[model samples]
Target: MYLTFITMIMTLVGTASSASFSAPNKDLMTCTIAVGWMGVALGALSFVALLQLRVYGYINTFIWNRKPTGVYFIAPIIYIISMSILYAILSFVLPLNGGFVYNNITNTCVAQNVIYYIGLTFMIIQTVVLCLLLFKARTIDSCFWEFRKMLLVASVGILFGIIVLAIQHVHFGDDKVAVKGILVIIFTLLPQQVYFYTILGPPVYHLLRHREYYLHEFAAIVEEKGLAHIYELAGGCPLGEISDLSDSGKPYRTTAVNRLSNDSNFSGNEPAPEIGAPLPRNSNPRQSGPLLSYYKSLWNRASRNN
Candidate 1:
């Protein structure tokens, strides 16, 4: 958690510094320093999440008796170690142009090529391993699906940026590629920042503010509903059939409603209740299940406490 907080602070600092020093006539050393800081901060932030995920899995296994597959435990450790080694090697090998006078264009280009290749290699490896680990974990637990999707989107954006940088490096002689690559990177950074905040910010905030409450609520729901039903509640499509019904310009009825109406238990020609209407008093608890019940209880508790 301290690492996460530090990462956020570093990211903000780096972004601000980059924006301030991004002018065409800006000192190259300053720009490089800002970029390097941002890179290290983001890299650390990325691995911190992996460590957290591993910790979460350990908790699930020991406390909840919900053991994730072995791969979930193993893959993250491998990725963290591999990435750490790669970063260490790159740090030693890559040259930082710290406002120094380069003797020639050749030396500058060589440094640029080394940094570009090292960064690109790290990105490729990180993307592949992280995606695989997340995907595998998602298969083991549906709750991770959102995390998997968000990470995949971010990875694709990064892969695109890396490709642009690669092109820039390969055509080092062409000023056009360098300009295009810089532009692409700037364009990509905005969306990636938005993605990070939009997808991750709320959950992190909630965890920080209501950590105990959130955990208790989750445990209650999982206990009450059973894991399979909880999974469905998390991932199920409540309005999935709405699109099909919309094409025919008919009011959408849920499968549950149709089944109830057809049964001897409910023999009314009366119109089905509105989509968002509350269920009847005698409605099956199994339909809505514990997830909904947990939310209601949580809301009531909050209201009372306030």
Candidate 2:
């Protein structure tokens, strides 16, 4: 979300300046450099996201053994801040036309210096790293499969955008309309498409069309992998309930209890398991976080509906 917001701001500033101001305009030059710096920042953030995903996959498989430290989170913040500053400094300090290239056809100032390509090259390296990481994590289970798919598509988009920018600089310099259109596609449409197809589209389709099956699969995976504690990191489920389910090694199901209580054959004299009751004799100790309570609520709703 931060990346998205920053990207939009950079894009708006650059686009507005480009459209409204002419060459040698101070605001235009400033926006151009800002755009370059933000682009590098975006690449840095993208790499961080990939690293986080890999870490999450590791956590899922061996969370207790390889739990992340504060450094894991703090380090990325430091890297991004430092890199953004370094990129901005280089853009201004370099002697190549103040790091701004003039477009004769569009009468606009843009950044196409060696420093800009250095940032672009950094993005290329990040893409290569993404491919290597994806290859390494190819055998990971379904927990990360969707994210891997998203990264694959994102890698392709990044590469395509880089190629388009390179081509625009070298060959299509005179075609203003084509240049602007490609920029819009690269900066805006490509990301929207990748995110929709990889993240948004699949989940929504599953929820709308295969909700029961989706929930069942989620329950099965959570149960089998002892991943109830993972949701504790996401701040929805209660640690006590998660620990109960994890310790018992059972997916929480209220169906049987609901059925027994609702059955006409059941008499009030007999004891019935209460809905949402925590299991007994749970002894798992690492239970201090917000977590898997959403699934519990989900189960509660499912039970009441039935």
> What TM-score would each prediction reach against the true structure?
0.46, 0.60
Native-referenced Cα lDDT, model 1: 0.42
Tens digit of lDDT per residue, candidate 1, span 172-231? Answer: 453353454455446445434554564455445555566335434443433343343323
lDDT of 2: 0.46
lDDT of 2 by residue, 217-249 (tens): 554454344443343332222211111112122
On the 0 to 100 scale, the lDDT of residue 192 in model 1 is 48
The per-residue C-alpha lDDT of model 2 at residue 54 equals: 45
Count of backbone collisions in candidate 2: 5
Compared with the true structure, model 2 gives a TM-score of 0.60
lDDT (Cα, 0-100) at 216 in candidate 2? 47
Count of backbone clashes, every candidate in sequence:
0, 5
